[model samples]
Target: MIRKVVILSMLLLILILFMLTIEDININTSARDYLFENGFRETGSNNLVTAIYLDYRLYDSIYEAGILLVTVSGIIFMSKKDDDVL
Candidate 1:
């Protein structure tokens, strides 16, 4: 009974908090402004996220692809059958 009451109160509190919170999505944050100001000049990319991942951290992207390739290869090797050994 006490647990149920506690859970109910906590959920009510969360609901009230969310209801009173701001709902603005077009908030021009500082990070967005900074990225907009420097993304093109620093990385020569029109898309900010693409500029970050492809231009600024090309090695990281390459390494992640390599890891994915290795993982797929391992999965394929493990999933293959030895039917010829019969």
Candidate 2:
């Protein structure tokens, strides 16, 4: 009974939080125009896609690379046989 009550409360909290977050989102329609006009000047990269990838989303790219490295390391560690451990 307590567990069900706790789960229901958690679900209600999550739903409330989701609703609150969703209410504040505003969509921008002129993002492409702004980017095209200023992307080269801001980033100094000739290629728009490269400028966006490297300058605009540098942290995202780094985090993705870090995740890939960790996943690969985990796979390697898990694949090792018991005899491989010193």
Candidate 3:
């Protein structure tokens, strides 16, 4: 009964918080323009977002690739069984 009440309270709080967040937030157009002016000619990428993601955030991309590789390795490891275990 206590657990159910706690869970219900948490759900209610989450619902209230979700409702409080305003969706229609204004974005800074100047920031976009600044990135475009600096990034396009400097990075040689046509898209500013792509240039930032590929170059400025290359380490993040590498880490993401590593995570993907680790996940694949985990899946492969789980799929394979040793003959000794069988």
Candidate 4:
């Protein structure tokens, strides 16, 4: 009984999320125009997405780099063997 209730609750939550995601709303139409008007030309990048990813949110990029570094380190650590195995 509890399992059925949990499954039904999960299904209902997923259905609500799907419905919410399907509703499209226009929130910011002038965001691009604003960025262009302000002087992205000085940044020396033609693509707005690249400019934003590399410069506007560099801290997030740093965090992403840290994640990659940690992932690589974990992979290397897990792949290593003891002296007897080596």
User: Each model's TM-score?
Assistant: 0.55, 0.59, 0.60, 0.59
Report the Cα lDDT for residue 31, model 4.
68
Which candidate number would show the highest lDDT if scored against the true structure?
A: 2
> What is the alpha-carbon lDDT of model 1 when measured against the actual structure?
0.85
- Across 31-65, the per-residue lDDT of candidate 1 in tens digits comes to 77888899999988888889988987799999999
Q: What is the lDDT of candidate 2?
A: 0.90
Candidate 4 runs further than 4 Å off: 1-24, 84-86
Error of 4 at 67 (Å): 0.7
Q: Rank the candidates by TM-score, best first.
A: 3, 2, 4, 1
Residue 20, candidate 4: how far off, in angstroms?
9.2
Q: Distance (Å) between predicted and true CA of 68, model 1? A: 1.3
Model 4 agreement with the true structure over 10-62: per-residue lDDT tens digits: 99999999888868655675867876865477566788777877888888989
Q: Which residue pairs show backbone clashes in model 2?
A: none
Please give the range of 10 consecutive residues that has the lowest summed lDDT in model 4.
Answer: 77-86
- Tell me which residue pairs clash in candidate 1: none
TM-score result, candidate 1: 0.55
Give candidate 2's TM-score.
Answer: 0.59
Any runs in candidate 3 off by more than 4 Å, and if so which? 1-26, 84-86
Best by the TM-score measure: 3
